[model samples]
Target: MTTVDATAIVVTHNSVSQVQDCLSALLSAGLPVRLIDNASTDGTPALVGARFPAVDLLVNDENVGFARAVNQGLAGVRTGSVLLVNPDCVLPPATARGLVEALRDRPEVGVVAPRLIARDGRVAVSAHPFESLTSVLGCQFGAALLPVPVRKLFSGRSRRRAYDACLRPGEPRTVDWVSGACLAVRTDLLLDLGGLDEGYFMYYEDEELCLRAWRRNAAVLYLPTVSATHVGGASSSPGQTWPHLYASRLRFFARHRPSTFGPVRLAVLLRALLGTALALARGLLRPGPAARRRVRAWREIYRIAAAADRTTLSQPVPMTSRSPSCT
Candidate 1:
């Protein structure tokens, strides 16, 4: 067996229920772990200290968002590689070792992500080509809402093919980016890239990181042979994170693709408007708690998208100024 020289870094935010399992799996794999709790009010830090005493626990006074928290964890990493696994993800020792081995074998690959299996036992689509204007608009328009055939027609066959390739079990394939739910990356490469972009509060940080890695000539590899179970949306609910999702998407486009920023912004605004109208109709027609929640979420998304270039809801401090307090 290949000995894995990697420290697992899990950023937790009220992930009390999932962190136990997540840490257990990493420790069982004999990997040193560093967990950064983003001011989780549900006693997540206490639980980790009590249950997994060996884990280096870093507690934040406020929720610093995913990218920043991960950067905080990266600051103290002494390992050759770092595993950025979400608290909701559980991976076997072999899978973790395989990720490290992939990096060991391929000097050109900076990031390697395992195939993510959803809680329902379905292979999740974790890899994707870098976002273009059409892809961005397709996602903004909610391609998943349509049937598979119609979705291909609406979102383009390339998107469907990309998803299909990611879901299909095969050899390691090069991709634009992989989900951050579980990924292993070289420590030196990550630090050289200046860590994850702190501008992203929650979403799109993984994409931005991969984009930077590619810019630095480091290939992002997707390994289907290695798989992990990802309990998606453990820290926050979809309704609660919709605004952040759209805001991060706009921020990503504005920074990377300046020419398409205007179109992407317009698409986001239209999508938000459409969602708000639909949610309002649903709330009026149904008159239930769920419907009301949908209306509120959609309104928040619209508010964020309408803010022009300042789409991010909160201002993030520079990564250099922040450091994790390890215990």
Candidate 2:
């Protein structure tokens, strides 16, 4: 009986309980929603279909990655705006409306995201600046070896708080990109930009979309007035998490930074390669299951870097009992 101008898209993969809770919360917002299931082995599709029949459901034959699944959901949207909410995120009442209103109030903003709060009530880092080769290198594991003060001074991780718009909750501000956990984007602009690049199997696709929007002179804004609870990393296991992350990083850098032709970029690539190699060696010599997982993740990173392609690590690494599972 409620009404909202935007269409909501919720993408689920192996999300059992989280999908139900997310849908329950979204129902209060009163927006038409499309639930896209990427071959989830769990009962996510059945739960949504049985309990929330009003939702438009698209079940895939296999896990088609996050970007592609979201793109498929986007295709069903007839509204002026679309909201991308992860299965693990719960949006508050009127939260979706607030984002849509922001877009309506400001014609220049192509994307807007609400502040993401953890279940523990802590603000999550949702907004971030664009990635550069130097910034990426500074965020690698080797930076942890530096003195605390020195690392804080130079590492990109240190500036994460500064870039997070949630820290300044009173006012809405422009940002480079917001987390895809709960982002509202103009449907027209999203279509023009080809939705998310299917090349990004998982991470950084949101960043790439916002970055492209900026290039087209559209602003990406972060409105902290509204918030969503995001239980992060629900889809990934520890054994394969780092691999997907680093592989996506490699893809983003390759797609955006001309590493092969530019001298500065080439130097940055060399530093990342050497640093990853040293870390992988250290992880191998270390003891325990955690250490072995680190080794596996680092080896995947090294492989992606060597191949200079994200597709090299496209397949999900098999996770065993020893691997940490996200609840």
Candidate 3:
């Protein structure tokens, strides 16, 4: 058995259903696993303590977002590399070892992520180009206004091609960013970069970290040779995650592409307005549980977007001398 010098870190929150399986796979593969529970109320900590006694469990008093919790686990890493796997992701031991080997062989690569497979056995789009004003607008209006075929003619085709390239087998490919759900990164590089930006409550932190790695001359490599099953949204729902998703997107633009932040903010607000209107209309016409849920979700999104400019919706945590090490 080939053992990789890496610590698998899984930051979990209200992930009782998935954490056991996630930890089981890693431990069965003979990997040192550390689980940082972000104040899970579902007895997740207790479950881990009882079932996976070998896991180095670190329990937090509060739900300190995903990035911060991961950093907490990273701080105690004694290995040369760290596997940042989500509680909902099942990475095969071979796949985990493959990621570590990729980083070990390529000194220039700071992070190597596996191709993510959905629970339904479909390949998930894991790598993406950095956020831009055009891409943002296309995602917002294009999907809502244009038909699927028509939308594909414009931005979808290019985006599809990029995703397909990331899914191709064989040699690792350099990408702008890979999903942090199942990635192996050099421990020294991750610590030197200061870990993920805590300013983001959730979302965009991975992309932001990858961007910083690139700026520091470290490549983000996507290895399609190994893949992991990611049962996404295991810990949170759309209602809980949508606002942070939008806020983080704007924050990414503000920090990396300041020139586009203003336009991106405006586009986000417009999206909120349009979504709310459509949701309301659907509710009025259909009048069902699903429609009501949609309306409520869009209304909450609009409420947040409306306050984006005046509030700290998009602002990140204030950087200090040694803080936000990735930026």
Candidate 4:
């Protein structure tokens, strides 16, 4: 097999120092890196140019969202595999090599993700099942009722499974999907799947890509043996906290199930409405702050999901199956 020539793409804005630090880790990992600056006033371009002269840089005038910026950076990448890293995620020196090895050894794999450890050494959801409207509901709204372990079990995932397997050391193990942060994807496969769907500005774009890969009969691989620390939401703005993710969920809904806006979309809308009503009634009777907050948050999620249905009414979706309500 040929050795993979990976290109590391890092997107940056005002946090030039953080980006530089992140790039240091990637460089140490021994990969040719590309830096894409999305219209930052923080002198990130100047700092990166001066400090890492050999790095390829793209400077945009405005913050053109993560999907598009990374897509632009991807256009210049044509050789081997492509590893996309969030500027805030500091990868270990061994990470790049391990990820590349996993992808190289696993011919069936389309994307590979390393286990994500928090700075404090806790595993912070390294991977997730392919998200559907029901999967999102079960995890988001049902978290109180279904704890992490139970949730993973219901979702058909191995929580405590070892990352290394002697039998399938170089083989691809099927996973719901791999995460976007510090993910290594086969460059050609990514291109064939059309890379990141620009429709999704941030959230769920990686999942969308993996789903496309799934449709094309490619496997999403997760290697616990290879690890990286994803300081969660590192590049996102403060306003992007809960609200941004809630809004972005709609983008995901639209991309995966484009037929929602038609008669099928109305069915989803009605389901969401009925579910929200039941949640509100339960909360009102219970009279607790937690229940009330949960009800409100769930309302917002479904509202956005319904809205996304409206936005993509004209597009035609390929296929779908039965989905559960979020409430």
Candidate 5:
């Protein structure tokens, strides 16, 4: 029965079980929640209404993407603080209240990111440093080149250090950027900063928002006292989502690091091309759905990379289960 001063903003896209669990957790916390349905084909709206009648629901005519859906929810928030929660993430008790307290206690902090625990019980790299050309390259393709065990170890190390994921749980530290999957920020500051940049349909939006906070003299704090169990990537396939990830990375570089943007873009494109080529070769020999999907994704990414003008490739390539080679 402990109510938090912040309102929870939940964005859903074809979510069923995860949405139920997310809403149940928020309602259990005695927090008011605003749910935004992005034209989900599933009867998620009806499910929310029937299961959690107290929720303030907004159903969009079409999928507006993550950042835009969050913006819509933010518009309806009357509370001083807002917690942006993804449908796939489940919150722990006192999580929202603790985050609100952190926001109130630290006036300099604009965004508070919680520790994200994955389903396998490993802590995900929710908080990360500013994406430089080097960091982006390392995160995207660096691990794939290594042996399976070494790749896992190397990625774990990089993720923990780059995101400060190993920091003590009780203490709060000003960090670069946190994942948008579950973040808390003052309503006023969010509005003043114009919320998330919609240019990014999905990935990198969080980093851009946190970077803006830093530019505006507000600290992006990582709070380990509270945590959320994130079932990451429930909504999109890895193959389908990779392009948006890289494209957003390109956009981020162009906007933030224009001086070296051209070279960075070239390097990103070359790396992507190489990946696609390898995937295509593997799919031809092995012939599996996963491998074929990977090839298709990289091919589309190749188109984006080889584009004469980048603006034309703004629309995100849809996530499809069918393999391009099979068709």
Candidate 6:
């Protein structure tokens, strides 16, 4: 009911409370909203349906990975702009209106990411370049191995990267990729790029989408002017998802940066292998529900990539989700 030429789609797993809170915050700020529940056994769909009767809901039988869920959610959005958001994110009172206003001036922008912060008040990961092997591995191994700044040429963990997109007391600037946690973009452009390349199961799908948009002569902007506090990874335990995250990373490397196909992919694979081995060595690990499903989801990505010519997704999307809960 808020005056805007846009409709938003938020995807959720089992985090019913977080999704509810997020919806309340978003609606209070006056944005038309819809939801796509990625098959939750814990009654997330029922709760959302009963509480927010005005929202358009798509309840799946099982979890479809993030990209597909977002694609499913987008189908019902009738407005000019479409937002892809996670259920764990709560928009600041001014965030929605500001983002809509920002979208108006930048018609060529395929996607825009807002300044994201953590609940503990730290800078959440937002507004970054393509998460290349060099970049991801740099974050893992050491900053010295690579020459250019890791996060951003200007903003690594240093004074520059840290403050480059800072929302504390200054203005926002544009960047290569905005975090997928809370991203808004034009509805038409999103469909044009095929709706987030389900090739990326969990992470880096945002990067893939933004980069594709960039190549299409569309800009991916980082607006520090508006902000959202994302209680990051509510659906996942950090330790468990690491492997799938790496797998998705490897798939990204294989699918995109083909020129560096040999050494670069090898480097990232080795790093991920080492990290997983170390994670195993530590023994403080648990495979949560999302992680377990992502294992299969990422595998599906690889399969989809391998059989690129064989598969044609012409029909409507299939609804899916896991029956088991997380650790």
In terms of TM-score, which candidate is strongest? 1
- Model 4, residue 17: displacement in angstroms? 4.4
Candidate 5's residue-wise lDDT over 1-327, tens digit each?
766888898988888768988998988888888898888887988899788889988888887777777777777467889999999999876788888889899899889988989888888767776866665666566654665345345554445554444344657777788989999998998888777777777788889889988898999988887889999889778897888887777777777877656777787778778888899889889989999899888878877766624444333332222211100
- The reply for model 1, stretches above 4 Å from the true place, is 147-161, 310-318
- Mind giving the per-residue lDDT tens digits that candidate 3 earns over 12-108? 8899999888998999778988888889999999999999889988888888788887787776577899999999999898898888889888999
Model 4: ten consecutive residues of lowest lDDT: 318-327
What TM-scores do the predictions have?
0.92, 0.82, 0.88, 0.74, 0.86, 0.78
Residue 311 miss distance in model 1 (angstroms): 11
Q: Tell me the spans in candidate 5 whose CA falls farther than 4 Å from its real position.
A: 144-170, 308-327
C-alpha lDDT of residue 63 in model 3 = 80
Deviation in Å, model 2, residue 290 alpha carbon: 5.5
Clashes of 2: 0
Task: Give residue 318's lDDT in candidate 6 (0 to 100).
Answer: 30
- Winning candidate number (lDDT): 1
Better structure of 2 and 5 per lDDT: 5
Judging by lDDT, tell me the better candidate of 3 and 5. 3
lDDT tens digits by residue: candidate 2, 223-279: 989999999999768666666666677667666664532433344456556655765
| Alpha carbon deviation, residue 254, candidate 4 (Å) | 2.6
Residue 110, candidate 2: alpha-carbon lDDT: 95
- For candidate 2, what is the lDDT? 0.76
Model 4, 1-327: lDDT tens per residue? 233478888888776757877888888766778787878898889998899877888887777667777777777476568898988788876778777877788788878877777778777665656555555554445543765556545553342232222112444356767678778888898777666766655667787778888888888877777678777765545333344465556556665555532444444445456656876788778878756665666566566656654456325332112111111
Better candidate number, 4 or 6, judged by TM-score:
6
